[model samples]
Target: MARPVTNAAFEALLHAAGYGNAHAAFARQLNHAGRNYGTWRYDAASVYWWLRGRRPAEHVQATMAETLARKLGRSVAVLELGFGAGEGTGTSIYPASAGQAIDAAERLWTTLAKHIRPPVSGTFDSGKALQAALGWRYDLPDKTVSRNGRQPVTTGDIQSLYALADHFTDLDRRHGGGSPHTRALMADFLVRQVALMLRGNYTDVVGRDLLRAAATLSGQLAFMSYDAGDHATAQHHTTVALRLAKAADDRLHGAHLLANLAAQAVHLGHARDAARLAEAAIDGAGRAPAAVLARLYTTAATAYGQSGERRACQVALAKAERALDRTGLSVGPRWVNYFGPAHLAGAALRCLGDLHLYTQALRHAPDAITLSSQNARTRALHTALIATIHARAGDTDAACDWGRKLARHAVGVHSARVEQRVRELTAMLSPQQALPQVSEVLYALSTVPAAT
Candidate 1:
């Protein structure tokens, strides 16, 4: 076989960036910048391979580009370093200017509108997510968001957008985000309507409100994509939302977006990243409403639990509980109204279950189920959690019973996250498939179609 072709462009960029023959120093900078993602012990030998045309991982490529940008004191696209285009490194998570941020958002929205499915790499950039969180907390808000465009944006227009967001959010909560039709409709709205509004003329005050409304809709789309198991799309939308929130000077909304990213990190098994993101959200949530604080705390608890920090998890859960108690007669943001008693109980159950504290987890299961009666998706997820808990405890009968309940509750739900839980429960029961109940549940699970 012929030898791999050397990446001349990468070498040229490295030389231009002053690395030239100092592969060791380049590797050191890459490793240091990579700490946000995880430990990277790359040395000269590792950089040598890249010089010989060995491509780095996507996240590593991003890190390398960022490192070069810092050294050169200029923006550097990943493709400029010989990496493939459209790999999510073209746009920075924290753009240097508001114009760049808008340009990034426009590009992402346009790409998403075209329904471009990114290659499924099954990779989560915890480092990028963490960076976005840090930027949101420390970066200065835009001085003014006033814009002049062809058509003028009005208060009525902003109100209409908020109403539409509420409608889409309700659809997502009820029917789940796995529906192709629902996803298409949301994308259509974002492109055909929201995009136009963003470019329309508006004053500073109106522009701030418009950005907030757009951020809310974008965040909902992010969660929906996440539920559909399209993590790349989710992250893209989340970045846009965070940018909008920052431009609007909405710190609480920014905190909510960070919490959502933390939840995604936890789902993707980056427990440490999840914990850091959640902690960032909590720290930046200054004077937030009680409901919002509770939501952030619960996210931290789940992340800590996943990391096996039992004491930290418990502390977060207790803080969540106290925040909820303080939410007694006050109405928080509509986006956070979902984090009431039922949601908190479900989070506690999942956190305890992550620690293998089945007995403690079970105690919260009833409240999770009963209180989430109207939320089919949450109920289905909690059902699967209960079944898994029993399966882990070696109670085949109890597990199978809850498994059947999960099947029932999952009938109309279209959530990839819930379906994943169902698959896990089935796997646990597969070992006991010799039993009639386990076999029956397994058969029931077989009929459940993959969430779209």
Candidate 2:
């Protein structure tokens, strides 16, 4: 017999799924959803009870819809399902159709995977997004638990690709970069798998569906190579992402992939190509989610900055802001939730700062600090950027204060990029060495611990 679900059990499941902070985020959303996320809220405990097979409070029947909708990247009117926000003693508002239920479950798992951090401890990162993403499509945990039956997809190759991604992510973290061979292997596997699935027993629904996933995985693998400075491999993987996106009829993913290509071009010093690609991405991003549109615009701004088009950069930044404004009224897709208003401002500010638009960049600095999360790497990077602006503005004491925080937070992380930024700022202080704050920054720099 299936074990009875309890509040603790469900909470434990969420923790195992890398949603340990979900309740807190849930509570915050409940308390301030209208002002923050532009939606209604739910009681976490009551929702837990509802999921455990007991009827929810009469007023909270829509809680499932609200929770699931947030996970699925859209607004929902779940309360209209014959109850209010806390009506525990009623019939389910969930669809009676199995197909409908499957779709909902898939969306929920996919969204959950995107938001949760991949497990990176032990042999590998536990609760990895890639794994979770794959599991959502191929493995049905709820079905296994609720139905006492197991069903596996026929595509072994796609499963292998997900496993490969997990291994690759771990290696990348430990070795500082993935090998070109591994990246290529993963891309080839995905492309081949997608091709096979397209031609196999799966109908258009399943084939296109699988292709969309394969393409996303391939794109990410290719991005890995790009980050490792393997531009050629990155190009190959990006092409796969584009092809897969088209196959899946997902214009948004394609646009974002193009932006990734543009970023790689800029990194490779092909500024003209970068700007052109970014513009294309922005133009095509019309059908994408709001967060995606904002991300594309930010990429365009970066490309413009690299090509030294001050006016173009400013225009792109404005477009980016507009994209963010759009999201203020609608929830973002799971993959794009991390690219919130704070991210938008931080990215735009960083690009402007990079282009020496110090005054313009300062305008967005406080937003970046306020909007950014508590993650160590992000905090370190944002603080460093903020301090860089302060240093440039001749605010030595303020610069040092933020800079010290950056250095201290960066300690014990495996990121080289953050350290490089710190070194660059330290060099920038040479002109202000006479200032006590400059000396203090220098001392702090000397004490920065090496990445473990």
Candidate 3:
């Protein structure tokens, strides 16, 4: 085993923040700042352990930095405190500014392009995620986005970027982002092509358009990372995308990115964080198109459902329904064109399923499956969800039937999300393995390889 190295930088920051050599004071401050997250019990001993080279939990690190930043009257990033990789180094979940966000995205793409795995702390920071959402909700738009670089960006270049984004989105929906080869290709494209375009010269008008397009691409990459079960990368990319959207003054896209983060939070079992993020997205979505509003509302419903707030979930679902009813009144952005009745139904299914209203959830499954037929990953997820609902409802035969369908749809798909649903379904049915139908479904699922 390697010897633990003391965190000299942390010690320096501790002193600079006026705690000096007093670990007890810093511990008290940390506990006070941590109250908003949850009840945290920290003492001088905890601080001593950190000083002795033991890393604290992710949320605790965030709270420590936040407390120090308050005392020092300046931003103190966790990386600066010698806890982990900071936003400047490209491992922090969110960057501090639009410029830093772009740089972080570039660094990440370049690293991935070289087949190097970026550093992941393997822990989700709910506090940091919530902070990013709040920032997106309240931050002022960038005054100007004009830049002078090696080449002049043109309207044609922006259009090509949009087209490339569409291409990648389609590919992700069809084959999922679980394949290492596909993810590498995307990183290479961003590094070799998109990075230069972002750095190229342009007017504010053109730059805003470029930023919006880039945000779309980055958001797609974020979703792809989520589908592949790389939560840290997904969170980083989502934060970068949120910054790009803000710089472009695109509140609608920013709201969408927040919703994505909310979904990721729900997946990671951070229901309260997910609820707060979804609420922020909805609150910041001013005068958005009906489709966008519907998506946001549905996302909130899912979060609320997971948090066990049935009334709030129902209200959100109703709002989603109202928005869908008015969707024909206006045109939404091309990026959100995927939202429709089927998408709404799928969201409702997940929300209701989480609430254990299995019958209501099952009502939406057919439409979700049929409408999402072209997207193998979506179909697989819905199928597994339906199967799980059936199993949970004590319908073994029906569950096995849906399980067989999931097995069919899940083959050749590279999606951790899909695999997760399958695992859930199998676990739900595992008790009835003696039954022939259950045994058959289990055997079929066994043939599917684990997602990369």
Candidate 4:
């Protein structure tokens, strides 16, 4: 009964609206709707059954919708309340209003928090993603239209969120995504604090600030989710982030999110999507600082490289390098402050690595490692790349030697992505597994706890 479509989304709404338990709320809702169901004395168990994919008689579905609508203070379409058919392709999340958007995000968070697999994000051609990315520039209706609420939100409240962004992002940079608890802490912070404040009263200007803060947290959660190999969860979070970015009218951060998504697409082997997303990022970026522009082109190069479009890849790489050349004198937002020549070197090394240009990767990957001292997780990845190139070169000894270093770094870091790099290195050295140096590294790798 629990395996089929559990009514998690409906349950989440019930909880989010503070009904406490399904038993009382479900029965009360039914009674309110005059649904006595003939001889049935509807109890919480029946409510539980209904949530477990049992169809409530037609009239009860309407009552449930109305109950939720009243609690949420918005008209609730049955489908929008997440009572829609459980699974299929082409589940669209582009909501028509802020309330709906928030509900969508809430449902997404609830699903992910419970470790349920979200439905696949409908696929898009390069054209559609490009349009979506570029469309963020167009003026849209304000998303934070709720000016009336119980508490009066202040600029100081918004500032605290910004401070939390800085704090949590630094933790991500230093520690990696090894600990789900830490990521959960960030999510809980959003749900408990940011989500609550979104329901509070604020002026238009303050509301924009509030949304921007939420957008930043959404991006952080998405990045960490991807780092932990939870791509589906990450996609849902990124979608919310993109929507928040658009709603806040934050073009620079919006471009940052799209560029990051492009890099992610390249990693997930969707090169065409990456290229289009990168292009879209640039299209609407509106004179961003050079570092931000460099990131966009760098990710575009990565996409092209993975697709075996050598000439196009080189062109993008050149543009990326040139953008870095101009980055020294510019100042951008903190979100993009991590980008520079080191970041470019890492991206370029990755492009070459994806293409299996081992010799070329070795040449620049070391420099990338050298330049990434500020970021521990990335340094570990770059180090692993160098080892991978060595492994490919048949320098089993050197590969094992460098592999040891990466494992050492991985052991200290709290990142599954870095450990995955260690795993990749282990795979590359698998042929020489019997060798002492390689065996030693493998034993070291064995000691680092695996991510669940």
The Cα local distance difference test for each model comes to: 0.82, 0.56, 0.82, 0.71
* Residue range 276-321, candidate 2, lDDT tens digits: 7777676665666667888888888877887788898889888888
What digit string (tens of lDDT, one per residue) describes model 3 on residues 41-77?
Answer: 8888888778887876444565687799999999866
Question: Residues 271-344, candidate 4, lDDT per residue (tens digit)?
Answer: 98888888878887868888888888888898988888878888998988888888878987778877767677
Question: Can you rank all candidates by lDDT, best first?
Answer: 3, 1, 4, 2
Selected candidate, larger TM-score, 3 vs 4: 3
**TM-score: model 3 vs. ground truth:** 0.80
Task: Judging by lDDT, tell me the better candidate of 2 and 4.
Answer: 4
Model 1 error, position 34 (Å): 40
After superposing all C-alphas onto the true structure, candidate 3 shows an RMSD in angstroms of: 12.4
Q: Against the correct fold, how does model 1 do in TM-score?
A: 0.79
In angstroms, the error of model 1 at 261 is 0.2
Candidate 1: worst-modelled 10 consecutive residues by lDDT: 114-123
Q: Any residue pairs clashing in model 4, and if so which? A: 178-414
Worst 10 residues of 3 by lDDT: 85-94
Superior by TM-score: candidate 2 or candidate 3: 3
TM per prediction: 0.79, 0.55, 0.80, 0.77
